[model samples]
Target chain A: MQLDWFTVAAQIGNFLLLLWLLKRFLYRPILAAMAARQQRVAAALTEAQAKAAAAEALQHDYLARQQEQTASRETWLTQAREEVVAQRQIWLAQARTEAEEARGRWRTELQREQQEYRRTLQREAGQRLLALVRRALHDLANAELEAQMASALLARLHALDGETRQTLAQAARDGCAILTAFPLPEPQRRTLTDGLQQFLSPELNLDFRSDPTASFGITLTTPSQRLAWTLDSYLDGFAAELQALIPPAGGDNASAYDQA
Target chain B: MTISPDQTILFEFGFVRINATLVFTWLTMALLVGSARWTTRKLSATGELSPWQNLLEVLVEGVQNQIRDIARQDPGPFLPFIATLFLFIAICNLLAVVPGYEPPTGSLSTTTALALCVFFAVPFYGIRRHGWRGFLHLYLEPTPLMLPLNLIGELARTVALAVRLYGNVMSGGLVAAILLLVTPLVFPALMHALELLTGLIQAYIFAVLATVFIAAAATAQEQTANLSQSRR
Candidate 1:
């Protein structure tokens, strides 16, 4: 085999031309396309990562705001509940106070009304008793009853202690007077006068007077000392005894009265 | 018949002669350049590729990958030269099956021309990468005693690249022609099929060896530096 210098030279020239042609046509464009595609993919990945991070930040912010709002709502709810409870307590206390004041006023009014009613009842009962006594005295009073009353007076005088007797004797020296519900006969007057002379000083002088309002009783008066027994005195003593027997009304015990 | 297609002189004028090997090589170069021009006329950079563009991309990308794998370097500087070598040899050998068509690669002249291109390309890439002084210094690697041996090894490998491809392709054609005369039917067809496989493998080996030789020269300084660092 022989190497032909001319053919070798020509073939070498041809191979170099082909190399130039292929480089221009094939390698450059394909490599450029591949590089462009890789760049696009990398950029897309970076953009997606940025978007995802932003979305995560937004989610975190939303969650924090939601938690804050929830806390605020809880605070408002608790405050509202407390205010409602406080208002309820205040209203309850005010209602209780107004009710107590109303009850106290009602009790005072009731007590006043009760006292007025009791006074009215006592006045009516006293008037009725006095009327009955007056009617009995009108039917039964005579000269004999008068004379018996005179004897009762003398008995009361005789029952006095020694000091009372001295007081009456001294009062008789100051000038004595006799009062009668009715005018007496000469004999009765003289008996009264003689009874007084026996109990007092013999030199004492007395005047007799008549009082029409002193029903069924007699009274003796001196300038400094007096002694009398009258229907009015006995009726006053009877009313006082009745008042002591009945207890006083309690304050604001309307419900207690219901139990009673 | 002449043993070499280069001896088949188609024309002669004074000292200049034109032969079948030159004609066939020119025809192959025309086919390659014409097809490239046609395919690249309406290239689409960003959209769906036409079938021609797709085929071209596959070929170019495949060549780039092969070069990168062999060279262990960026395929950009070596891709076109290496790809052209493989395509020309493979196409020339593959077309041998055509009636009345002689493969230019069957000639020692074409194979030697390709090996000589690789031989020159190795020094070209080395000098470009590390300058002339650094490229000359690689022969004295490890010790200065290895200079002649390294120089012989470089020439020997280039010669081997040319002889090996020429021998395989020429023998396959010769065997097919002899088999056609002997048993014209199945044996020749079988030999032609075997030739197709062998032709492709030889083309691949040529291109890979070219890439390896060039890459070794280009990165020799770096390799030596790495070796020194590794020793340390």
Candidate 2:
């Protein structure tokens, strides 16, 4: 076999014409459609992402607002409790003060009434006693003219034991004796000097000064000691004896005597 | 180179002698038609194709895929034309193996015709895609001064495609013939294998060049359109 030029040329011409026709009719439309579809898909994805971001932003805002609302509510509640507590304390204090004032007023009124009642009872009792006394005297005056009698009665109180008596005598004579007049009474002076000499066991020098304020009393004086037995001293001793006899309700007799 | 009595009988057609080459060309066309029909009948979206149909589909799909990648578009509409071109060239190359068959691509006339078809189709598709103005603007690509160079480049590409296939296929056949005449036994088998290789290579070159031309036409048209719009 050999190569033929004419037939090959005819065949090639046919193939080229066919290719041109196919390209014109087929490939371009399909490519355009594919490109458009890709663009649409890309746009959709972008829009979806944008929507997701917006949703996230909204969620964040809602959460922040919720937290703010909760905080404000808590503050409001705390403030309200403080105000209520203050008001309640103020009311309680006012109630307690009013109760105390009412109690004070009731006590004052009761005291005033009690004083008036006491005064009335005493006056009534005194008037009754005076009437009774006058009646008895009138009755006794006629009876006394018929008969008269006279009698004397005496009782001896036992003195304390020796130790007690000695303790009392020593306490009474312990301080220095004093003479109030410029010239002492001879008996009183001698007795004071003798007592001091005996107690000292030797002769003692004494000085005396008169004080009108130490009236009607003997005061003995020595160079280092003095003793007072004035009327003011006697009164003071009597007062002390009376104070010891009447002890305060809860105090001991010994403590009362020591105070006197 | 003595012609046999049967060869002479087959050559006499009316008063003019019809070359054995013409018969081989007819045989190639017949083979193309038969294969095309067989491949078409086996085409199914459902099960596997027979081996022959599978081979045809692989060849078609390979060319189609190449065109689609280059053209950056669907090659479905162009499949018939490209597949036919590929099959025709393949069959023409294989015809060299048949007892009295010759390769059509080895002839200058056939190669020139193929080149002319590619040349004409490039402009035709460019015009179809971007109109007549766009087709003319292919010469003026890059700049007005580039028009002559672009034209020359286009001519050169066509010539190169035609000459490349013709030279390669013709030399292979010549070598096989010379080796067969010299050592008729061992060399013929080696020549046959070499011829088979040559045939496949030339077929591949032809299909690849066709795809490149189509891609260039489409791209040029796109550029021309863009230029005109920018100018506007």
Candidate 3:
């Protein structure tokens, strides 16, 4: 039931002291620690947000670059395809041109070969006709044939005009000779000699000779004057007619033509 | 037989006297301060907490929440005073079971000291928040005729606060002593265990009552000011 004022005052002081001590030691540090932890958490959340934003931006950039690359690649592919088509067209045109040139060269060469063949054929035909005529004459030739040729010569000498006979007789006075493709018999030779002396001159010396290449006929020769009555003349006229009848090479068939 | 620890004077000088209440009060204070120091030396701002730190945080947060709930305001300014009041009384009463131990709350002088602290703290907080003139005007609320009655009521309540705590702790001690003389065995032990529970409850009541008084003084003028403005 009694009270102690000293103890009461002491308790009050002790309580205040305790209050100050507890505030200093306990509440302040605990609150500070909790606040620090909250600050660190907030900072970490902010940093994470920033990193996420950066990552999103990077992803956007990467997508844009990838899209651009894809577009460029498509462009390149399109350009390449166009180039390929153009090159193909160019190569096709070149190929066609080369083919046409080759065909033209081939045709030209063929035409040249055909013209050469035609010329060779014409030459062969002419030569064959000439050889056939020569062979027929050679096969038929003998003393009898020469006697007929001598008679033809005598007729030709008798049928000569006076002026031609005198000109021939004068040409014969210088040097007189007779040539035949075949050797004449003794009578045909004497006949040719007498026909020549009587028709041309009495004192005209006469000579007879044989020549195989004399065109299968007789020919008379003097230094500057000559007379002939030979089958070779007829053969020359026949060969000229045959040549006129044949078509000429190279004028019409010089080039070859074709359609596309 | 002494009903209060103040009668048990252990030391005396010519004019100053040291009693059992003072000694036990010091002991209780040491226990509280030492434990607080030990737990708060290394506070972990992050990561896992130690068991002692966890217990201390729970105790402090619980006190803060109580003050905030009852006062309907921020508990920051009131936390230290109220927490100390509960801890000191609770520990003092709880230690009564120890042999040769005296609880300081069982003394009228100690309870008066605590009640006086609350009595003064009410005005201290009121004046700190609203100024002396505004706080002094509170006793004249409703009319000046109620001034003397309100003053008497405040004094009576303070006396009641002290007497109520002293009567409970002193009577519990007295009853245990008498029961020890009568039975000396299981009944006294049971009463001591019961005293522990009542001691905790009384500490809670004391702390809550102190918070109510302080909050009432602190915010009463602001309410009056608002009412006057509304009337105007």
Candidate 4:
């Protein structure tokens, strides 16, 4: 086998050329691409991690806000409940006060109406009683009835105490006077004079006066002392005594009367 | 028939003779360069890759891994030289089956050129890593009295590398030719197929040896420094 130094040199040159060419074309670009891809993948991973951290922080913030809002809502609800209860209590108290006031006014109104009814009943009864008495007096009244009522004067004079008898006797030094609803008959006048002269001095002279509107009664006056009794006076006194003996109509009326 | 592609000169202008070895080498380089350019033209940094691009990436990555494994260092600096040597030799040996195609690797000149490249690359990388003095210091390893033997060993190994490749490739082609003359059919075809296996293996062996030699030279200075420090 023969060696060609020239061809060896050319082949060496070719190998070197091939080395340079392959380095430029193949190794440089492929390795660069691989390295670039690795870097890009790393960057993507890093970015994803950052985004995850941020999202987690945001979630925590949202949770905290939600909890705070819940607490605030609870506080507001509690306060509102208290206010509602307070308002209800005030309303109940006001309603109770208004009801009491209305009841008081109704009671006053009822009392006034009862009093008016009683006054109307009393006036009607009094008028009827007076009419009945007048009618009775017209039917049964005569000189005899007048003389009988006049006889009570003697008893009234006899019932007087010694002090009052002396006071009357001393006051009767002036002439005595008498009043009546009608003019007295002779017999009735003598009877009243005889009865009055027993308590007073025997020298007491009597003056008699009559008025048509006066009560059907006798009245005697001796400047300071006079006495008389008549059928009209006797009837009016009996009616007043009957009214005083009657019981009260209602408990409310008795309490009202006591209060008045 | 001529035994070597170098003897098959197509043209001559004195010593500047154009031979079949140079032509085939040029053809191999063109194929390598063109394919490299084509595949790398749209090199994608992400996503799907074209089939050719995938094939090229596998080939390049395989070379890098092989270099890294043997050298125990970063494969970046030596990747192109080591890979190109394997690709050129393998392609040349594989093409021998084609009628009238003379493989450049079957010539002594091409193998010597490759081995000489390896021989020179060892010192070049070592000197670059540890300076010329540190690299030259490897010749006196063990003792200064062993310097002549060490020099002869270095030269002998370079010759062994060239001869081993050339002998394997040329003998495969020559055996096929001789068998064609003797049996003319099936035996010669079997030998040609066997030559393909041998060719690929020789390419692998040559690349591994080159890697070992270069790695030793690159790291020898530091090893020597450590040993000296330990001894002192």
lDDT of 3 by residue, A1-260 (tens): 89889989988888888778878888777767767878988888899999999999999999999999999999999999999999999999999999999998788878776876877698678869888987887788766887788888788888889998888888888989888877888888888888888887888787778887676777889888887777777777777787666555654455443321
What TM-score is obtained for chain B in each of the predicted models? 0.95, 0.83, 0.97, 0.96
Candidate 4 lDDT tens digits, B48-109: 88888778778878988999999999998888789889989988888889888899999999
In candidate 1, what are the lDDT values of residues B81-173, reduced to their tens digit?
Answer: 888888899999898888877899999988998999999999888888878887887889979999999989999998999999999999999
Consecutive 10-residue window with the lowest summed lDDT within model 3 chain A: A251-260
Per-prediction DockQ scores? 0.38, 0.07, 0.56, 0.57
- DockQ, model 3, C-alpha based: 0.56
Fnat of candidate 4: 0.87
Question: Which candidate number has the best lDDT?
Answer: 3
* Pairs of residues clashing in candidate 4: A220-A226
Of the candidates shown, which would achieve the greatest DockQ relative to the real structure? 4
Higher-ranked by TM-score: 1 or 4: 4
Q: Interface-residue RMSD per candidate?
A: 1.9, 8.1, 1.3, 1.0
- The CAPRI classification for model 3 reads as medium
**Error at B48, model 4, angstroms:** 2.3
Candidate 3 vs. true structure, TM-score? 0.70
Best by TM-score: 3
TM-score of chain A of each: 0.60, 0.35, 0.57, 0.59
Model 2 residue runs over 4 Å out of place are: A1-260, B1-18, B228-232
lDDT of 2 by residue, B79-117 (tens): 555565666677778767877666766665566667777
True contacts kept of each: 0.68, 0.15, 0.76, 0.87
Candidate 4 lDDT, A1-260, residue by residue in tens: 78999999999999999989988997787778777777888888888889889999999999999999999999999999999999999999999999997787678767866875786577568758877987788577555665666776677778889998888788878667877766779878887787677667788788878776666666667778766676666767776765554333454565664564
